[model samples]
Each structure stands twice: as C-alpha cells, then as structure tokens.
Target: MNRYTFSTQSGKAYYCNSIPGFIADQSTDIVGRLVRHAFDINKEQANAWENQITELQRRLEECGMEGDIIFEYDIVRLGKRIDVILLIRHMVFSLEFKNGKDIFTTQDAQQAEDYAIDIKNFHKESEDLYVCPILIATDAARYPNPQSCDCYPDKQVHLQRENIETLIPKITKISSLYGDDGEIDFDKWFNSPYYPTPTIIAAAVEAYSSHSLSQIAQSEAGQENINLCEAKIYEIIEYAKIQKKKCICFITGVPGAGKTLVGLDVVAKSLDDANGLSVYLSGNGPLVEVLREALKKSVESNDREREDLWKRAKKSAGKTFDVPKPEKLFNKHTQAAINTLIQSSYAFKKDNASHSNPTPENILIFDEAQRVWNQEKMARKHDDPIMAVSEPKLLFSIMDRHQDWAVMICLVGLGQDIYDGEVGINEWFRCGIEEFKEWELFYSPLIFSQVEDKNIDQEKILSCERCHQIDELHLKTSIRSFRADKQCQFIDALLDNDPKQASEVYQQIASKYPIYITRDYSLAKKWVRAHVRGSQRSGVLACSSAQRLKPEGIYVPTEIDVKNWFLAPSDDLRSSNMLEVVASEFKVQGLEIDWAIVCWDADLRRSKNGADWDHYSFRGTKWNKRNKPEQKRYLVNSYRVLLTRARQGMVLFVPKGVDPEEDPTRDTEYYDGIYKYLVSCGIQEL
Candidate 1:
C-alpha cells in the first residue's frame, strides 16, 4: 500500500472516481491503524471520517482543480496526519474536514492553522510555498469570500466553508496573488526533509519508552556526546541492577549540554523494569513546573479520550475499569497519569518524612542536583515546618532506608547554581563522605575541577571507601546552543574575569551566534525582535536582584508567571514571545530561547579592580553592596544563567542610568563598567 492513501502530481485532475479506491487503500495504510485506534478511544472521530470522505468526494466533483492531491498525508514528526493536501502552482492548501458539523468552531480554525504552521516549519520543501489552511464544516453556511487578515499575511490563509462550490474560486484568486514562480517538483515535495522538535519532556518520554535516543533531535556536532551520555547512563543503571549495590553517580555537563535530558531519559527507560521503578526529581522549581506541565500536555494531547474509551471497550470484554475517586490519580503503573514519575525535590522531601522511605524504586534521578539547599539555608528558615540538614543529606538518609539496593543519579550543570541556598556540587560530595559512607559513590573526575568548589577537600573525597571516578560521566559539549559549540566557553571565560580569552573566543563564534551589547534598552529590544523569525522563541531575562530595572518596564518578580510566560502563544501578552515581560535567572536557568535580551542592572557590577564582581541589592532608595563571599558567587552565577539561556543569540540592555544625579540608585558608574567589560569581550554594540 502507498504511504498516503491517495496522491497525484501537480497539474493533474483529482478525480472523484478515485475516492472509493483511496478509502479502500487507506484501510491498510498508517491511517487505518490510527482510525482503528480512534474507534476504540473516540468513536466520534471514526464516524466523522466516513462523512469526511464523502464530502471530499462530492467537493472534488464540483471544484475543478489543477493540482496534486494527497489524502491522509502524514505531517512531519508531529504524529499528526492532515486530511488532504492540495499542491497547486506555487501554493499548498491544507484542508480540515468537519463533515457532520453545522458550525465552524474556533478550535477547528486553530487546528487548521497549526497544521499549516507545522508543515511550513518542518517541511523543508514547503517553506517557500504559500500554504493556506482551510476549515470545511460541510453543513455550515458557505462563506463566498475568504477573509483577509494581516496577522500571518502571505504565508497563511484561513477558510470556513460549507462546500467546495466557492473553494476553486478562492484557490484561483490566492494562486493569482501568491503562487510560486515556477512549478514545484511533486516528488521532491512529497519526500521533503522533516525537522522534528520534541520538547525535553517529549524526548525523555520517547527515549524512556523506546529504549533509544534516535527520536530526539540532535545537531551533528553533539550527536556523539548525546549518544555517549545516554549509553553511559544505561550502563550505570544496568550495573546497579546486576551488582545489587547501592550507587550514586554524578553526570556533569556544561550549560545546555542535555543534563536534564540524560536524567529524564534514564528515569523514563527505567520505569518499566521489574527490578525497580525510577522517579525524576528536580530542585529547580520553574524547571520542574514547566517540565511537568509539558509532560502532562504531551500525555493529554496523545490520549485525551483513551481512558474513557478503554473503559467502554473493557465493559464489552467482560473486564472492569475502576472509576477513579475524587482524589488525584497519581498511582504507579498508570502511564497516562500526570507527574507520577516526575516530581519536585521540595515536594518529594515535604511529603516523605526525613527518616521514611516511601517507595522501593531502585533509582532516583535528580536534575540540577547542585541547586539543592545547603545546611545553612535549610536550618535558617524558622517558619518552615520540614527540617533537614541539607537536601543531599536528606536524600541519602531517605534512600538509605531502602531494603536492599538503590541508586541516585545527580545531573549537574557547571556554573548554573544561581540561588543563595544552593550549596554547589561540593555539598553532595561532603554529604557522601561525611555521612553516607556506606553508599557507593561514582562521579566524573572533572566534577571537582568543573565546579571549582573551594570548599571541597579532594584528598578526603578520594580517600572515601567506595568512591569511583568515571571518565564517561562527564559531558563536555553544549548541545543547547547548536549555533556555537564553544558559546559556553566564552561565557565561562567572561564570568571568570579572563577578558582576553573571552574576547578571543567571542570573535570565533560572533558571526554565527550574534551577541549584541547596547546601553539603550529600546535598541537592544529592537535587535532581538528583528533577529527572531518564524515561531523562534525570544524573551528578556534579568537577574533576580534586578529590582532597579522596574524603571525600564521590566519587573521580574511578580510581573511574570514563568509557566505562562514560557508556554503561552505569541498572541498572548503573557507569553515570552511578546517580549513585554522579563524572566529572571530563577525562572529561566535550565530552559532556553532562540534569542534573548539580557537586561543588565546594577544588581551585579564589575568591581573597581575590573576583575572581581561586586554584588548589590536595591534597598528603598539606595544600593547596598553585599559583602558575603557566597552571595557574590550566586550574584555572579545569576548572570551566567541569564547569558547562557539563549540558544541562538542574545542582546545586553545596559541602561546609561537616567541622569545618575536625579536617581542615585541608578548610578551610571555601576552600569558603565560592566558594559565596557562586556564590550572588551568582543560582544558587538548595536
């Protein structure tokens, strides 16, 4: 059977006589499997399909068209199949059929547009073509003319029609205005390259379930490292299972090196084993929230009606489908559930008593393990109910309660600990050596050197009874910024006060991943807005301590809801795509955007010596310098997080300090020094 049930080349008649054959052929194609599955889950869809075919057959008989037609055409990598695709001269039409409907719903229109957008973004051959998505509600009144809107002009068109009487006329008019310069190669368009972009959540889910990383998109440069990381992780899991030993391994990587991906992948693939289940935990609240939501959305989108349908089908099979109670469905083995396998560290710690071990799950994967709280932070908070020495110590104590064997995987990112409570990587080593010596330890030899943790005594760690350093555990490349592999190196050098080296590294990657620096906030914003294309994400980010930035219309704290800001559509002002709101390091540390505007404030500035950092906090009408060493480190790391959050490029908006005399809090000296230091690093000024 053909991949598509029906397909014809451009400049050919799509005859109504072939509809029956197409339907018969589709019964054996991919769409057949989808339809059978839909019948078991959503019977309405199965009924709709029959009527849809009849309507399309009737419509084609009425509308005389000169184009290629494809029925049940699978879109690129989205796991979605478009109803029909009409390839005409210089234009492609995406048609959605609501066969039994009398009214065109908003959701129908959005789905049609989303299909067109997916095709345009993922289909390499369709990028230059004018793709118009039409929604046909067969029973609805016919709209004789297509509406004109400037929203996605030239690239997108929307049509709501009752029949195909006016469809040909509209297509002719659209072709006359925006048709391609020449005829397209039908064979090439049919086999165009598809670019798949699975979110970190989806990638993890697929990798875990499939026992392979083939589905996750990777750049040619980082594919080897990504594969190596996945292989090493799998080996560790198998070793723990075979050895029947309690082990803890640290997987360290540069910023955006897929550290979280490695953790999630391990958890996903490990959950199905009879030996033990795995749970993924993250100390980063925003990371956890966004990832959990994304995972929930992924599960919901794929099997929205699976549960109800399964219940109905099971009744006929003489099986019981227990109706869920009022409580939340967070049970093990319920793969369709939400946040069952993935959880937040704070929530997990809070729910489980310090001395209690809830599950026998042999493995616990910790993403951003370095962000775990220190002994001081946990103890200092008086009003908080839960008491723990440190997150690592607490984690070890709970896992120690395991009956036989267990493993804890810590996914670490270098220089990404951006909060005060964060104790860095040393806390885990200290906890393991000083307290949980019975648990076996395995980590990359580069962990100590990468974090530069002055608090760690390497000799004591090396002398630990069960400590083992594995070279395969360290990930060196930055997969996040595919445009420049060495972008993290430049950021590290700049943050480490090596301006000369930073400048040299910047020049090498400047052409590919542009980094713009400007004192004018508006110019920096404009630069970011102009650079981002298609649905490429762009946003403004600042350090959490950027209280003085409110004057520039960027209030980082209460103004932005990180979840909505990150996930909302471009039309929603709350979305990051609007560039109206700014996310702080706390909200955007692990995630990335296509382009970003790093709003530099007086929160962290270059010291007089021009080598070290001086941290400041805005208090009322004055700027107070924070003299604590730990605070200084966090303040510096905050900038590192913000700077590295951009996948493609970034622009720095350093305000010139509106007449420093009028507002002493906005001193020009504080802003100028950092701007000059960044300029010295070979970052271009707009």
Candidate 2:
C-alpha cells in the first residue's frame, strides 16, 4: 500500500512529460485509493479530496512547476492528514484547502500553520527546508496584494489561493536563502523519519479511544524505549498470572520521559485481557481530571457519529422510524466506568480501604508514584487509625488481597515531589522490602544511580531473593520537549548552582528551544503570547508559595478549574490563554503548556551571597525562613515543576522589588540576586 493517497513524483509519475497525464487522471480512481487507506471515508471527505486534486493540478500546471505533489500526507501524531505537500526545489509547501468556502477563518489559517510547524519540528528531512503553509479558500475573493512571500523566522509563510501562480518565482528567489540550490530528494523527503512527542493528554485520549498508541508514539528511539518498558511490565504481569504469585514493578525515568505514557499504554493494551482488568491511578488531580474529561469528550463524539449513522440506515430502509430521545453516552454510568479505568489514587485508596475483598482488577498502574503520601501525612488525613498507613503500604495490602495472582506497576518521576508528606520513591521500596516480602519485586537500574541521598537502603532491597533489576524499565530521554532533550539537564544545572554547565547546555538548545528572562510581568506575558500560535497553549504559572506575586496580578490562591483552564477555547475567559488565572505547580505538575510565564517570588530566592537557594514562606505580612529539610526540598521542587512545564519555551518573570522602607517584605535584594543568577545561566533577557 502507498504511504500517501497518491503521489506525483515516484516511478512514471516523476517525469515532467507525465505530469499533465497524471493531473488529468480521474478523481474516482484517486478517491478509491484514498478510501482503501482510510478507515471510514465519507462522501464529504471524498468530495474534498477530489476538489483538492483538481485545484492543485491546475495551480501546478499553471506555474509550470516540476516537483512532487503528495496528496493526503499522513501526520500520525495528530491522527490527521495534510491535504497536499508540494515539494518544488528546496521549498516544501503545506496546503490545506477549504472546499466551497467563500471566506477564510482563523481556524483554517491555524490548521494550515500547524501542519507546517509539525513538519518543520518533527520531520527530520524538513528541519532545514523552507516550509510554506497555504490556506486556499476556493470561492473566496482574491487578495489584492497577497503576502505569499512574507516568511516568519521559522521559514513558514501563510498564503491564500490568490496569486498562487506567482508563488513559484518568489520561492525560487528565496531558495538561495536556504543555502541549497539542489532539488530535493522526493523519495527521501517523503520517507523521512517523523518523531512526534504528543502531549500527555493527547496520548491518554488516543490510548483510551483507539486502544492503541501506534499513532501517538512515533519516535523511533523514544517510542522503542517506551514500548520496551511496556513489554517488560506485561511480561512480569504474565509471569505472576501463570505462576500464581503477586509481583510489583518500579519503572523510573527523568521528567518528561514518557513514564506516564508507558502506564497508559499498559492499561490500554490490557483491555483485551478477558481474564483480568487494569487500572491507571495517579495522585495528581489535574492530570486525572484532564485525561478523563478529554476521553469522555472523545466517547461522546464517537457516540454522536454512531447515532447519525443509525438514523441514516433507517432512512435507507424506506421506513419512517421515530427518533428515540437522545441518550447521552457520557452519562453517569459512563463516567463511573471511566473513573474505574483512570482513577485518582486517593479516591482508589478510600474506596478499597473499607473492604477486605479482592478487587476485580488484577493489574494496577500507579502514575507519579513518587508523590504518594508518607505515613505521617496519610495518618493526619484519615480519621481512622487503621487506614493511617503510608499510601504504598495500603496499596500493597489491597493488591495482596488477591490470593492467586496480581501485579502492580509504579511509574516513578525523579525530583517531582512538590508537596509536603509526599515521600519520594523510598517509601515504595521500604514497603515492599519490610511488609510485602512474598511479592516479587522488579526495579529499574537507573533508580540506584539517581539516589543521591542515602535515605533508601539500596543494599537491603537488592539483597532480597525476590528483587531483580531490569534495564528495560528505565527511560533515558525526555520525549515531552522534542525540541530540546537536554532541557531537564539544564534545569538541573541551573538549580544545582552550576551556571557554567547550564549556560553551555543552554547554548546548544537556545536556537530551537527558547528560554528568556524578564523583569516586567507584562513583557513576559507579551513574549509568551507572541511565541504561541496555532492552538498552542500559553499560561502564567507560579509556585503555590509565591504569595507575594498577588501584588503583581498573579494570585496563587485563586482556584482554577483545571479542565477548563487546559481545554477551553482561547476566547473563553476561563481558558489559560486569557492569562487571567494563574496555575500553581500543584495544578500543572504532570501537565504542560506550549509556552509559559513563570512568576518568580521571594518564596524561593537566591541567598545573599548567591551561594545557594534560600526557602521562605509568607506568614501574615512578613516572610519567614523555612529551615526544615523537607520544607526546603519542596520549595525547590515547586520551581522544578514550573520550570519544566513548558514544552516549547518559557519566560522567567522576576519582579523588581519595591523599596525596603516602603515595604520590607518586597525588598529588591530578594529578587535581584536570583534574576542575575538566571542571566548568568544564559537565559536571554526580554
């Protein structure tokens, strides 16, 4: 089968003499070919493809262009396809045609630009090539002076169908600007490797709706690592099932390393198992809420399509069928089912703590397991002393109820514990070693490498007979920031007070992944707004302890509806795009935005001598130092979450403090040292 619906640059189609013949080919043949590649081709889609082909052929022939015209180019990450890709010389044109439309809309323009950006960022061969995104509204009035050649820094030009015939000459003149005059290799470009790092929300929705992550997981290296992790966990699950033994597996990775993706994939694949069920649990409330909401919307959409098909089938039978009252697919029962599949760890604990019976699910995947509460925190939250055990211990006891077989997979993130009483990975191992000795234990070798603090008893855990180290369980690279894999490393160095190393790493990724600093909050907002485009999300983020930022129009105390904040339309006031509401590290820990404005406050500021960070908390009107080790770690981790939340880029907004005499709490010394330190780390000032 062909990779695309049709191609004009392969085999006999490559010759310029055969171009006219190919253009004049029947639309039915092309439609039929596209139908074979698609799952369900509607009449509207078929007509659009036919019209796109006819319009494209006329434009190509009029321009006398001799290059490849790929119809229906697949963009696997988005689960959508570009209408056409015109590869002429060193230029790559991404075309999105709006059939029968007389006016261009913002949605269509953004869609066109998104395709170009995706190709430029993810497609290996198109990285350096000039990509022009054109939105052609077939019936729209032609622009008197179309800016077809006005290219952005990323080499993307948005244009209309008007004056498209003149595009070839303009493209030819700019080909020299790309530093390559040679013709593009059509085959190589068409078959180029595409590494798309989808947002976690996108991955979860795809996994739940399609029950397959093939389209979402596209990177060769990153996807292979995730797949291996999934496979190894499944192997352990199967062994436990066959041997009638309980087992637990720990999978660790750096921040944004697709650890959550592995857990979601395991749950998705396990749906096929009729013998048992799998559940994905997370302590992060916002992450669970967003995923469930996205998946619920997907379910409702699919149901609506099915209902439409049902109505059409009844009409075809020539029988007048009374339309039944619309039954909502995303009703209470459906929500209950969704909750069972992807649940909050706290809720899961509460539901099972009251019962001694075994759960129907034999496999449980814990996401962000490092954030599980320690015994002290758990005790204070629960009224009953019997339920006061640490989260891991309680979770293990629940799973241990299954006498025959059960499996538990913990997805651990390093340096992500941003809240009090959230014990790191040590709690899980401690529980496994001291309490659940009968259950077999498997962990990533990378866990030991990252344990800098001697809190975990590695020797005792490894010496156990049931404990085994598996190399495949650890993910090495960061998939979230496809533009910069070393972003986490840079953040580490910056926080570790190693400005030289941080500056060196920043230099390497400065061009592709922008990191800027600004003293003015408005300027930081403006910078993020300018960089965001095409449905990309940008938001203001502050640490929860940043109480002083309330004076700067950033109120961390404001409770944001995360589902709306992350998923609402840009025009909606509730949307993060509005930048009215600020999300704290607590709300956005496991989530991400395309661009971010990180508001810095006196809560975690550089020390007087700039030797280390000093942690502080706001009490009444004055700031008090937090000397506790746990308190200090949480303060640092809060910034870590905020710093790493941006997938594309971020702007650190360090407010200029007021005069000490006017307000001692807002002293300039509190912020100046940190701002200077950030500059020394190679963060460009806005």
Candidate 3:
C-alpha cells in the first residue's frame, strides 16, 4: 500500500514467485492503491503491466534464468520508475512495456534508455555492470535485427526492440553475448547510492519557493561555497539594515559554480519581508523566459496532481489546512511572484520613472552583471533619459532612491562577456567612484589586481574608505563538470593556445569526459548518437555569426522558443535532441547539455601564428571582416561560450571547406588551420 513501491529478488536463486505473486494479486484494494500511488496510471498502463508481467514470468520460467527481478523499480530522486529491471549475472536489463502498440516509437525508446542511463550514471551497484535498455512493444510486427554489443562503450546503453513473442530469444541472445560472470546481489543493487541531478528547471522552482538548495544540488564540492556565499550575503543584508546605509556586493564565479542558484535563493528568502523585499533581475533573455515557463509548469501541474492527495490526507488526519494555490502565487499579474521575480534589465530601464521607486523591492540581485552595457550602447539602443548613462550607474541611482537602507548583489561571471557592448567588471568600478561614492562597495580580493585584461581603475576603487574584500564572495568550483573539476582549466589552456598544458589536462580527464572532433558533421552526429544513452541530452551548437554553416546544412535557430528547445520530447523536430535545428551560443550560454556537436565555421578560427578572430558580416554575396576591437572580441568570446557549453563531452565539427574554384568565400585555407589546431590541442578526431 505504500507509494513508489518496488520488489527485488536475489540472483542465482531465481524469482521464486516474488514478482509473479505481486503481479497476480489483482484485488480491488491493491489495484486501487496502485492507481492512487502511481502517476498517470490508467487502463493503458495497467494493460501494459499485465502483459509485460505475464511475458516476463513465462520467459523466466521457461529459460530458468538466474539473478533477480525487480518490479516497478523507483529512481526516487529523478522522479522516474522503471517497468521492470532484470539483474542477471553482471548485466542490468531496463525494460519498458508498450501494450497493443504496433511500433516502437522513438520517444518510447528514449524513455527506456533514460531509465537505463539514470541507473548506470547514478546507481552505485549498477555502475560497473552492463546496462541494456530494451523496449518491448507487445504487438509490433517484426523484431529489430540484433546487433553485436562490441560497438558500445562500457556502461553506455543501447536501445533494443522486441515483441512479447521474441522476449525469450532476445534474452537468450543478450545473455550469451554478455556471458554470465557472477550472480547479481539484488539487495545491494536496491540499496545502491543514488546521486540525483535536478535539472535547472527543477532547481529554480524549488529554490525560488522553499530556499532549499542542498536537496536539489548534489555537488559535494560546490555546496560549501554556495552555503558560504549565502551566509555572507545574509550578513551583509543584516548590516545594511542596522546601519541604514546602501551596500553592494559583487559575487564572481567560474562558468557554472551556482551563481544563479545563490541569486534565486536570495529571492526566495527575501519574499516574505514585510518592508524591504527583493527581486532577481537578469539581462539574459533566454534564461528568464526558460525559468518563467519552467516555474509556471511546475506550479500549475504539480498543484493539481497533489490536490486530491491533500484532501484525502486531511480527511484521514484530524487537522485541516488550506491547499497552497501555486497558480495564484505565480500568475502573470502578481508582480512579486516568479514571473516578475526576474526581469530583463532593458525592460526594467524602459519602465523606470524619473522620481519614484519601482515596486518597493529594496534589495536587488542582478544575474550576469558583467554583461551590462556601457553608456554608448544604451544610448544608441534606447531613447529614455537613463540611456546616456551606464547600466550600473542607472541601477545604483534607482536603488539609492529608497530613503531607507538597500542592498544590491551583482552575480558576476569571469570571461563570459560574449557581446560587443559588454564592458565586464569596469562599469561597476566607474559607477562606484564617479556616480555613487557614498554607497559602500564589497568584492572578492581576487578581482582587483588580478583582472589584467580589463582597464579597471583599481586606484579609485581602493581609495574608498568603505571598500571591503571578502574571500567567501567568490565561488572557486565548477559545478557543471561535477565529474571533472579540471574542465575549465583544460578549456582555458586550449583557448590560450597552450597545447602542452591542454593535452596534459585532457589526458587526465579524457577517460571520464570524452571530447571528440571531426571534419564531417555527419560523423559528429553519429558519434553523439552512439555515445548518448538514457535520458541524456544532445544538440548541435554554432556561433551566432556562423552564416557559412548554412551550406553545411546547419542553421542557427533564429527565434528560439526556449521551453520547447530545452524540454521538448526527442521526436519533436524543434527539440534539441533532433540535431537538425542548432541553437546559437547566445541562446545556450547559461545552460548545459550532456553531449553536443559544436559546428565550427570561419567566424572564429586559428591562423598559423595564433588564434584569429574574423568578424564577418554576410552582406550581398561576400564575407566582410569588421575591423573593430569590440566586434572581434565578441566573435572570439562567442566560440569560447560554445566550446564550454557541454557538461559531459562535445564534438567539434570543423567543416571541410569548398574548393576555391567553386565557392571562393569558403576556401579550404580558411578551415584547415583551425582544424589542425584543435587536433593538436588533444581533441580526438573521429
């Protein structure tokens, strides 16, 4: 009668009727209990389970297979349940049942594969075993041609199809291919350590509502820094409240060290303040859109799912409480809810009034603060009064309008300014000295003299009596590459053209995280398909200025519907899993994917001497290089963003350019040098 139920049996002992007993007990009470506890359980699911159980029982009884059988295995943290997991010898068979279905859909295969992958990646006992995900569509016409298992990497899953009639032969083939080594200990497998990775969508919703971060973020190395950052920010907020003075903190981190997580935590913790409230603001349009839609879906759908359960629990218990209305809290009209908790800086500027404070949120958290525009870009883009001033100066002025104390936290990232107008960290220094001298400034000690690339006035910032530097303000770990901490180091060495160091670091981490390169996009796609298993995400990525990639059949998604592009089913053409429509670096900056194909074009390439940044505008029929410093930097940084987007591994596809006699624009000379450089940097060429 418990929710999220599962049955397990030891290997070598066989089933002994444990699984059969559970399936055959089809009383009204038991069925009702299962229907209530399990999600999306209907006649279709019941029929599928009944058929799958009967077939599995028959196969086991006839074959006399050893090992264990687990029914309805629960991947509790990921919110997934497998139909049946067969632990035989050292292999884990992840089965998904489709009843009365004639064909095995791609989505169905992906769903089965995801369950297998989740166990292989996160289940300790199954990590060393061969995980095979099989989809059994009971009424399918024909069985898939069984392929040898030599092509797959260790623990890498492959999708196999079967029908109810072919189940015995399929099992025999798999068991023979992967010969039985030893009996599987089902008790140990059931209790194996499961490290759950909450998607960014789930993390955002949980953090914004409950301020509980540790449960969602399973990164052991980065959790300390997250906690430290949060504690320091809270300390600053308390000080600002007591002293009745304005304070600003600049929190910096390497690419994916949970800066956004800290920012959302602040927004959640500050929501209920009767007087001085706070809102999370960002300049990243795609991030905002994705987060809003994800939060909306979480609230609306989850609330309805739990409503009936809440009523039933209340009836059994002696106490009654009002059900939480997530829709009301996160609706569009509610300014303080999730939709308005984050807003675009440009939109905030457009809505700014000359003399009034906007919406009474005294505390402001700005994500990606380094990407804020300087005065010139703002003036050219906007006609408002604040357009002539830098964004930081304008924001400081707006916050200073409050008569009481206020706090502003700038969630900054180092070396992520991939746009022309971004002034990096210097804009904040200028604003602090010339515009808002009275407000206190706080930063990490590593920011001052360490920033060599930017022209920051260190003297002006250091001269302020209220300047304070705190070490806890900076996050030192990269949470995105939780398996390989040296991922960012390897990227830096590669981008800096230090091939020796890059190769050394790659050798250290290559076994854990694989990076491949190819001259053909087809090879890259094929490699991605082979390596990716389970519910792992894969996509094609390109630079925003990759106009030449159109000839290679790679088109950048111009108008990205962030939700569908990130969360759609694999079979959908719009989904990133399709590998047809590629997303640009601009749309995928703060996100991570499991596997990716980075299509390298001539926008940014390597010359014989060093890295080359050619900013080209495709006007008429030719590529004209824009001779501007900012434009060149943007082009270079765009590649940097694309290069580091993949969390697990990536394949760089440097095109083999057309002959000079055919298309002069895409000459062979333009691409060969870059491809060679990438190869030299220890990227395995496929």
Point out where model 2 deviates above 4 Å. 1-21, 143-149, 159-181, 218-221, 300-334, 451-454
- Candidate 3's C-alpha lDDT? 0.73
Report how far off residue 129 is in candidate 1 (Å). 8.6
Top candidate by TM-score: 2
Q: Which lDDT tens digits does candidate 2 get at residues 49-104?
A: 67766665776677676666766778777667787777766788777777666777
Model 1 pairs in collision: 90-180, 208-269
What tens-digit string does per-residue lDDT give for candidate 1 at 228-288? 7678767776776777777889999888777777776666666567777888888777877
The Cα local distance difference test for each model comes to 0.71, 0.80, 0.73
Q: Comparing 1 and 2 by lDDT, which wins?
A: 2
lDDT of 3 by residue, 1-686 (tens): 43223433212121222344444454343445445556655454554455556566666767767665665677644455676777766788888877667898776877887777777766778767888888888899776565445525655546778888876677677767784788666556676656545556657777665655555565656777878888899999999998898999999887777788788777776766776788888888888888887677766655665554455444544354444422434355543466667777778767764556655788999998888888888888888765588888888888888777889999887667877777677888778767787788899987764332367777777787788889999988877775566788888788777888998999988887788888988889998887766567789999877888888898886777767787776778878888887889888887777888999887776654656434665667777886886677667667777877777788889889989899977888888877888788798877
TM-score of 3: 0.78
| Best first by TM-score, ranked | 2, 3, 1
Ranking by lDDT: 2, 3, 1
Q: After superposition, how far is residue 84 of candidate 1 from its true place, in Å?
A: 4.4
RMSD of 3: 6.6
- Residue range with the least summed lDDT across 10 consecutive positions in model 1: 10-19
